[model samples]
Structures are given as structure tokens and as C-alpha cells.
Target: MRALRYYEEQGLLASARSGSGQRLYADTAVNRVRLIQQLYGAGLSSKTIAELLPCVDAKVSTPESRERLLVERDRINAQIAELILARDRLNDIIDATSKPNPTCDYV
Candidate 1:
């Protein structure tokens, strides 16, 4: 709930107020929140997400927005590649240690 209000304050989301002044959200709000969460997970800042939201809402992309999206995608790809290498290295270490060695004391 706090996150919803924060998102709203950041201009990343919208809500309607009831007569009693409670915030109300449309059904589409669910999908919007999910997309916002995904973008944040992808390491996008709130400012960038705010900029991207209009493009998303309109289903149209300007050249700048397209470039920004591509840049973020490339960054995530590079991070993924680095993580895979680290995981493979850990696996190699585990494989070597798991083999029985006569000189090793630990079970």
C-alpha cells in the first residue's frame, strides 16, 4: 500500500479518490503495477520509468524512448552474462571439491 502511494507520488501511477477521500484504482492498475515492478527489477530508476510510462500507455515509441529501451536491455544482457560466468566458476569449484581425495580430511 505504501508502495502504491509512492508510485503515485512519483507520477508512475494514478488513482482516483472516493467521496470519503480514500484512493481508488482501476482494474488496469494491477497490470500497471506489475509492469512498474518489472521495470524496477530491470534496474530502471523512477525518473526513467516515469518517462517510459507515457510511451507505454500510448503504445507508441519515439526514437529516444526506443534507444533508451535498447540501452537498458543491453545493460541487463551484460549483467546476465557476467552472472552466468560467476555461476559456472562456482560450479567448477564445487565439482572439484566434491571428488574424493585421499589427502583431504573433511567428509
Candidate 2:
């Protein structure tokens, strides 16, 4: 609930209010929240996600928004590449450490 409120405050989400002031969300809000989580997990800042949200919500892109999205895509791709490299490095370490060693009792 706090997270929903934060997202609402950040303009990444919207909610309606009932007569008793309870929050109401449309069915689409679930997908929107998932997308928000994905974007954040992909390393986008809230501000950048906010800038991209309108285009996503409208399903229409202006030239400027298209360019911005392109830039963000590139950024995400770079981060993916970096994470892949890090994973490979960890795998290499694991392979090396997993070898049987007579000298190390822990092994």
C-alpha cells in the first residue's frame, strides 16, 4: 500500500477514491505496476520512468518521446551487457573454486 502511494506520488501510478476515501485501482493498474517494477529493475530512475510513462500509457509516441525511449533502450542494453559480464566472471570464479583441493579442508 505504501509502495502504491509512492508510485502515485511519483506519477507512475493513479488511483481513484471512493466516497469513503478508499483507493480504487482499475484492472490495468496491475500491469502498470509490473511494468514499473521491470523498469526499476532494469536500472531506470523514477524520473526517467515517469518521462516514459505517458508514451507507454497512451501507446503513441511523439518524435521526442521516441528519441528518449531509444536512448533509454540503449542504456538498458548496456546495463544488460555489464550484468552478463559480471555473471560470467562469477561463473569463472565458481568453476575455479569448485575444483578438488587437497590443501584446503573447506574444499
Candidate 1 whole-model C-alpha lDDT, 0 to 1:
0.97
The number of clashing residue pairs in model 1 is 0
> Best candidate per TM-score, number?
1
Angstrom error at residue 62, model 2:
1.8
User: What's the residue-level lDDT of 60 in candidate 2?
Assistant: 94
Clashing pairs in 2: none
For 17-54, candidate 1 gives per-residue lDDT tens digits of 99999999999999999999999999999999999999
What TM-score would candidate 2 get against the native? 0.84
lDDT of 2 by residue, 1-107 (tens): 99899999999999999999999999999999999999898778899889889899899998998998888899989988998999999999989988777998862
Model 2: runs farther than 4 Å from truth? 105-107
User: For residue 38, what is the lDDT in candidate 2?
Assistant: 93
Residue pairs whose backbone atoms clash in candidate 1: none
